[model samples]
Target: MLPISYSSLNNSRVNRDGSSRYRRFIPEYFRRIFHYPQMDIEYTFWIMFYLCFNPSRVYKITYWHKQTKNQWARDDPAFVAICVFFMAIASMSYAIAFHYLSFFHIIKTIFWAVCVDFISLGLVVATVGWWVTNKFLRVSAHNHSVDQNVEWLYAFDIHCNSFFPLFIILYVIQFFLLPILLSSSFLSTFLSNSLYFIAFVYYYYITFLGYNALPFLQHTVAFLYPIILIFTFYVLGVVLNINFTISIMRFYFGQ
Candidate 1:
C-alpha cells in the first residue's frame, strides 16, 4: 500500500475497474496563499508565460511528431521568440519589482516571501535547469526544467557567418546591470551590498537547514565577491574591451 497525499485528491474515484478519476490540488490553500489581487494577476501572468516559454526537452518524442510537420524542437525560432519575449518580461518585472521594493518594501510579508521562495525560486531554478540539461542529458521530462544549471546561449544562432554561444554576456548583464541601471551612490551601494550578504547568509542557513561549507562559499559569492567582480568587470573589462563574453562564446560554440 502507498501513503496518500492530500495534495493529490480525487473527487471521483474507482478502485478496481479504474472507471474514472478526478485530479486536483488544494485550491483553498492556493487561494488563501495568493489572496492578493495583484499577486493573482502576477501569478497568472508568470504561469502562463512559463507554460509558453518553458522548454519541454523530454518531449523529444513530441519532436518526432513535430519533425513530420516541422522542426520547432531544438533551435526553434518560435522558442527563440518566446525566449526574447519572456526575457523582456523578466527584465521588466525585475525593474518594476525592484523599484517597488526599493521604495516601499511593503510587500515583504512572510506569506508572500514564502510564496516567492517556494514557488518562484523553485520553479525558475528547476525549470531553467531542466531545459538546459535536456540539450545534453536526455534526462526525463519530470526533472527540473528551468534551472538545470545549464548555460544559455545569448546568441546561439546569431554568430557572424558562424554562430557561437554568447550567454556569458547575458549573465554579465544580469549580474552587473542592476547597479548601473540604478545609478546608485556609495550609501545605496553599501545597502545593496548589505542586502546581498543578508540574502547569502539566509540562503545558506535555509539550504542546509542549519549548517554546511557550501553555503558559506555560496554566501560569499552571492554577497561580497559577486559585487566586487561585477563592479570590476563593468569598469575594467568594458573600458579595456576585453569582451570575455565574445571570446567565451567563440570557445563554447566553436565559432
Candidate 2:
C-alpha cells in the first residue's frame, strides 16, 4: 500500500458530496480562534478590502476555496475575529465620541454593539440563511447517494463578509460624517438615511453573491429580494424625515 499523505487524509474527511463534517470542523474552528499567530491577517484584510471595492472578486475566492478545500465555507476564523475586533473598536470610538461619562455605560455600549449587534444578530441571520438555502435552494439528490447542504458556518461567514461593508459604511464612514448626519435638516436626514440605504443594499448584494457562488445552490437571486423592501423603507424614511444614523446613535449612547 502507498503511504497516506496529509493531503489524502484531509480530503478523506470531506463527505463524498463535498460538504464538510462539522463534527470535525467546529472544534478546529474554535480552537484556532485563540491561536492568533496561525491566523492569516493579510488574507483577511485582503478579503475586507475587496469586499468594499470589488466584492465579486471576493466570492471568486470562495469558489476557488471550494475547488481546493472541497467545501464552500471558510475553514479559517481569522476573518470573523478581525471583524469582531473592528466592531469593538468602532463601538468604543462611538462611546467616547458621544462623551459617555460612565465607564459602565461605555462598556455596555461596546457589549451591545459587539455582542448584540454583530454576534447575536449575525447568528440569527446566519441560521436563517443556512436553513432557507438548505431547505429551498439546494439541488435535489435524487440521482446521487448523498445531498449537499449549505454549511451553517459558511452562512455565518457570508454574514461576516457582508457585515464588514455595512460596518465600514455605518460605523466608520458614518462616524466621520457625524457632524452633518446629526444635524436637524432635510438634507442631513436624507444623507444619513441614504447612507443606511446604501449600506443595507450592499449587504444584501454581497449576500446574494455569496449564495450564488455555491454550485449546489439555485435561485440565489431570491437573496436580493430584500433590497426592494429596504428601498421602500428608505423612501418612507426620507418622506418621514427620519435620520437613521442619528436614531442608531441615540439608541447606542442616548445622544
- Give per-residue CA lDDT, model 1, range 1-255, as digits (tens): 998865445523334224322114433323343344323444334423433233122222333533484422222233333333444444344435344334233333222333443335545644543353344333233454423222232112111001001111232233355454333354434433433333333333222221111111122222223445555554554455444433432342232
Worst 10 residues of 1 by lDDT: 157-166
List the candidate 2 regions with Cα displacement exceeding 4 Å. 1-26, 142-146
Clashes of each: 15, 0
Tens digit per residue, CA lDDT, model 2, 191-244: 999999999999999999999988788999999999999999999999999889
RMSD of each: 18.9, 7.2
Candidate number with greatest lDDT: 2
Off by over 4 Å in 1: 1-20, 23-120, 124-183, 210-255
TM-score of 1: 0.23
